[model samples]
Target: MKRLSVSLSAIALIAAIPLLGGTPVLASLQKAGESIVQTLTRPQVKLNLGAEKQVVAQDQSGKEQVSWKSLEGNAVVQPGNILRYTVSSENAGDVPAKNLTVTQPIPQQMAYVLGSATNSNGAKMTYSIDNGKNFVENPTIQVKLANGKVETRPAPAEAYTHVRWRFGKSIDPTTGVKAAYEVKVK
Candidate 1:
């Protein structure tokens, strides 16, 4: 049917943040002793992203089963429909990539599913409620109590504006890492 152009430039932006590190590797130059040549070796990560729509069905036993259909093709979704977004990354460079991070923004018309964010690389997960400027493990909001007192409480799912995952370890060359999260159409 129809092909959608889904861009994931955020991954590239995050990957490039750690470019300045050790000195470049030395290479052979002309005349074998004239001058030393420097070659920059760094991690070049590639990312692939996909979106799927969740479908629920009942079998003969009347048990509910969930299935996902790729959103790459012509797909129509209604309000309250669940959609899962997955991003896969692989390093193709000579050196390992350190402190890998991925941030995903929640659509204005969608509500994030709490506890639905997952990473295959054992990353530290954080949430952002104010666009993407700030992030915390659990975003909180101050609510005024009945007695003219204000208390801080965990922000609701609808308040989630972004989700971020930070990997503690370095990703080796050709290693694949995946992250996913679910959101519901508002």
Candidate 2:
């Protein structure tokens, strides 16, 4: 009878060992899964308009590499003059970034000169006639004529300005990106 009791006790202890060890492991796995889910669903984006500063450029490359000092001479003026500004973006994440878009609010003092924006990667540029309400490629005013009557229509607000660029490709790892354009300030 004593031997029988010892054997039964050993079997109970062996079974209990796995039960004890598995509870902690299962709990750890559950926590890890929750953490991964939270991370995947979170948004990772940082946007800010650089400080209002002046930029000046003497050459194309210098213009491309915009700086506060480079814009010293560029200002809004009447006809026969042009002003330029640069907008920059950065991939501040660990993974590759795709479909990168940069937007700049058209300063009230300037008007976007159609077809003035240039991109290094041949990106498609668009314009918004309204205050960023809508965007369209090759935006133009529509004219309706009926019985010798004509009506003019403007584009939505989300239209492109002189400095819109869509980096259709991925910005690798961690790097800063920039886009610039010349605008006529009225």
The reply for model 2, stretches above 4 Å from the true place, is 1-69, 72-81, 144-163
lDDT of each: 0.88, 0.61
CA deviation > 4 Å runs, candidate 1: 1-40
Name the candidate that leads on lDDT.
Answer: 1
Summed backbone clashes in each candidate are 0, 15
Kindly give the stretch of ten consecutive residues in candidate 2 with the minimal lDDT sum. Answer: 47-56
What tens digits encode model 2's per-residue C-alpha lDDT throughout 1-186? 999999999999998899778978789889999999867654344543432333535785554544543434453345534555656656666666778777666766666655556655556676666656666675666566877766656643324343456778776555656666655555
Candidate 2: lDDT of 12?
Answer: 100
Per-candidate TM-scores read: 0.78, 0.53
lDDT of 2 at 19: 74
